[model samples]
Target chain A: MIEFFNVLLVIFLILSALAVERTKDLLSAVIIFGAYSFMMAVVWLLLRSPDVALTEAAIGAGVTTLLFVGLVSRTRRWE
Target chain B: MNDIIVKTVTRIMVPFIQMYGIFVILNGHISPGGGFAGGALIGVSLILYTLVFGVGAAEKKFSHRLGDLSESGGILIYLVIGSVGIVSGGYFLTNLDAGFLKGEAGALLSGGMIPLLMVAIGIKVTSTIITLFHAMIEEDPS
Candidate 1:
C-alpha cells in the first residue's frame, strides 16, 4: 500500500512538473510547481528524510510559490 | 484580498503558525524540522498576512527597520556564540568543548550550543524572507 502511494505521488510529481513547464499562464504554472514541490516533499518523507521533506515543503512549496506569484504580478502573467 | 473570510482566517491562523515555527526551531536538535523550515513557516505566515492585509499594515506590524535589525542581529548572535569557542582556545563553534551544558540526550535543553545556533538561523532566515518579499513587492523606483 505504501509503495502504491509512493508511486502515485511520483506520477503526480511528474505530471505537475510537465504541467508547470507547459502552462502559458505563469500564475497557474507557479501553482502547479507548488504542487510538484509538495509531492517531492512527500517523496522525501517516504525516503526517510523527514528533514529534507520539511525544508522542501516550507521553502519549495510555500515561499517559492509566493515569490513566483509576486514575480508574476509584477511582470507579465502569460508566457 | 478584500474577503472577510480570508482576513479572519489568516488573523486566526498566523499566531498558531508562528508558534509551530518556534516549536520546530526550539526542537531542531532533536526533531526532523530545523531552523530553515521553521523560519520559512513563520515567514509564510507573515507573507500570508501581507497578502491578506495591505503591505502598509504588514509593514506597520513588522517594519523594515525591525527586519533589518533582526537579520543582522541574528548573524551577530551566531558570530558571538562561535567566538566564545575561539575565545576558550578551541575552534569556532566548538559546542561541548566550549563548556556549554550538554544536559541529557533526547532532552530539550541538551545539545549545548546547537539549539542556540538553530534559533539564530531561524531568526536570520525569517527576516531574510520577509525582507526579500518586501523588496520584491516594493514599487519600482524608475
Candidate 2:
C-alpha cells in the first residue's frame, strides 16, 4: 500500500513538474509548481524524512506559491 | 479577493495555522518539524490574511516597524544566546557544556538551549518571510 502510494506520488510529481514548465499562463504554472512541491513533500515523508517534508510543504508549496502569485499579479500573466 | 467565503475561512483558519506553527516550534527538538517549517507556516498564515484582506489592512495589522524590530531582535536573541555559551568558558552555542538544564529525553523542555534557538530561528524566519512578501508586493513597478 505504501509502495503504491509512493509510486503514485512520484508520477504526480513528474507530471506537475512538466506541467509547470509547459504551462504558458504564469498563474497556472505557479499553481502547478505548488502541487509539485506538495508531491515532493509527500515523497520526502515516505522516504522517512519528515523534517524535510514539512519544510518543503510549508516553504515550497505555501510561501513560494504566494510569492510567485504576487509576482505574477504585478507582471504579465502570460508568457 | 473580495469573496466573503474566502475571508471568513481565512479568519477561521489563520489562528489554527499559527497555533500549529507554535506547537511545531516548541516541540522541534522532539519532533520532525522545526523552526523553519513552523515559521514558514506562521508566515504563510499572515500571507493568506494579506491576500484576503489586501496589503493596506495587512500592513495595519503587522506594521513594517514591528516587522523590522522583530527581524533584528530575532537574530540578536540568537546571537545573545549563543554568546552565553562563550561567556561561560565554552564554545559558541554549547548547550550542555554551557550549563543549560536538560530534562528527560522526548520531553518538551529537554533540549536545553535548542528550544530557545528554535524560537529565535522561528521568529527570524517568520519576520523575514513577512518582510519579503511585503517588500515584493508593495514595490512600485514603474
Candidate 3:
C-alpha cells in the first residue's frame, strides 16, 4: 500500500516537473513546481522524516511558489 | 485576489496556524518538529495572509523594522544563551553545567537551553522568510 503510494508520488513528481518545464504560461509552471514540491514533501513524510517534510512543504511549496508567482506577475506571462 | 472565500478562510485560519506553529516550536525537545519547521509554518501563515490580503496589509501587520529587529534579536538571543555557559565558567552552549533548570526528561521545559535555542531559531527563520518575501515583492527602483 505504502509502496504503491510512493511509486505514484514519484511518477507524479516527474510528470509535474516535465509539465513545469514544458508549460508556456509561467503561472502554470509555478503552480506545477509547487505541486512537485508538495509531492516531494509527501515522499519525505513517507520516508519517516517529518521535519524535512514540514520544511519542504512550507518553504518549497509555500514560499517558493509565492515568490515565483510574484516574479511571474512582475515580468511577462507568456514566456 | 479579491475572493471573499480566500480572505475569510485566511482570517479564520491564521490564528490556528500560528498556534500550531508555537506548539511545534515549544515541543521541539519532545516532538518531531523543531524550530525550523515551526518557524516556517508561522511564516507560511503570514504569507497566506499576504496572498489573501495585500502586501501593504501584511506589512502593516509585520513591519520592516519589526522584521529587522526580530532577525537580529533571534541571533542575539542565541548568543546570549550560549554566553551564559561561558559566564558560568563552562564551555559555550553548556546545558546542564550552565545551571539551567532541567525538568523531567519528557516535560516541556526539560531540555533547558534546547527549547530556548529552538525559540531563537524559530524567530530567526520566521523573520528571514518574511524579509525575503518582502524583498522579492518590493517595487524596483528603476
TM-score, one value per model: 0.97, 0.97, 0.94
Q: What C-alpha lDDT, on a 0 to 100 scale, does residue B110 get in candidate 3?
A: 93
- Residue-level lDDT tens digits of model 3 in A1-79: 9899899999998889889889999998998899899999999999999888888987899888988887887788998
- Which lDDT value does model 2 have at A63? 98
The sequence of per-residue lDDT tens digits that candidate 3 reaches over residues B16-71 is 99999999999998988899989998998887888778889999999999999999
lDDT against the true structure, per candidate, is 0.93, 0.93, 0.90
Query: Which lDDT tens digits does candidate 1 get at residues A1-79?
Result: 9999988998898888889779999989999998899889989999999999999999999999999988888898888
Error (Å) of candidate 1 at residue A71 is: 1.0
Q: What share of the true interface contacts does candidate 3 keep?
A: 0.66
Candidate 1 lDDT (Cα, whole model)?
A: 0.93
Off by over 4 Å in 3: none
- Quality of candidate 3's docking, in CAPRI categories? medium
The digit string of per-residue lDDT tens for model 2 on A1-79 reads 9989988898898888889889999999999999899889889988999999999999999999999999999999999
Give one digit per residue, the lDDT tens place, for model 1 in B50-87: 88897999999999899999999999999999999999
Q: Number of the top candidate by DockQ?
A: 2
lDDT score at residue B46, model 3, on the 0-100 scale? 89
